[model samples]
Target: GIQVEQSPPDLILQEGANSTLRCNFSDSVNNLQWFHQNPWGQLINLFYIPSGTKQNGRLSATTVATERYSLLYISSSQTTDSGVYFCAVGGATGTYKYIFGTGTRLKVLA
Candidate 1:
């Protein structure tokens, strides 16, 4: 089994401002994914980086499996980006389970 924790807990930003979110896990994970849940409850997969880094438009992610942590970066934040960002981790253990972090709530104002 794995346990996940997210920092800051919440965030508020003005439009165009950038921010970084972090996720920490207690156990080794075979798969890691970052998701953004929009205001309307639509879940968007932002990244699936088990290691290294990845970028898509104004969003990017980096994972350090060895250190048991992951990072999500948002650049040029927009009002539409306001939502709950989650980090879900899947363990390699026999049970094959996925543990999710509490989530980071982001608010971007105009």
Candidate 2:
């Protein structure tokens, strides 16, 4: 079985600040995605990096499959970024089920 854990379960940041979120998995995963759950409860897909690194706007993510860990970087944070960030991964050996990290709750103060 594969397990997912997210660090800094809660975070508080001032506008324009930067933050890094982390996710650790117990096993290798072929499918990995980072998502941000907005204040309205909408899950926005931030990245789908099963390996390597990618960036989008003020956000970036890196997944080291060999290390069984992934990281999401948020730069120049904004109040709009206040929400819950999650990492979801699949392809856990013989199972097709996807597992989601506990989530990292972020609050950006303006």
Candidate 3:
């Protein structure tokens, strides 16, 4: 079994600000995914960063399996970025189900 933890349970960002969210895992993971759970509770997949870094628009993610941690970077924060960011990890021998971290909730004030 794997354990996940997220830092900064809550965040407040003014429009145009930047922030970094972190996730730490207890064990090695074969799969790592970043998700943004909108205010409506819909989960939007941000990235599947098993390794390296990736960016899409104002959002980016990086995962270091050897260190057992991942990071989500949000730049130029907007009202749309207001939501809960979650990091999910899947390991071998498991059901392939993702184990999510507590999440970092962001509030972007317009």
Tens-digit lDDT string for candidate 1 (1-110) = 58899976999999999999999999888899999999999999999998999999999999999999999999999999999999999986756777899999999999
C-alpha lDDT (0 to 100) for residue 102 of candidate 3: 91
Tens digit of per-residue lDDT, candidate 3, span 1-110? 79999998999999999999999999888899999999999999999998899999999999988999999999999999999999999985556777999999999999
Question: Which candidate ranks first by lDDT, i.e. highest?
Answer: 2
- Per-candidate clashes come to 0, 0, 0
- Candidate 2 stretches greater than 4 Å from native: none
Query: Quick one: ranking by TM-score, best first?
Result: 2, 1, 3
lDDT of 2: 0.95
Supply the TM-score for candidate 3.
Answer: 0.95
Off by over 4 Å in 1: none
How displaced is residue 68 in candidate 3, in Å?
0.5
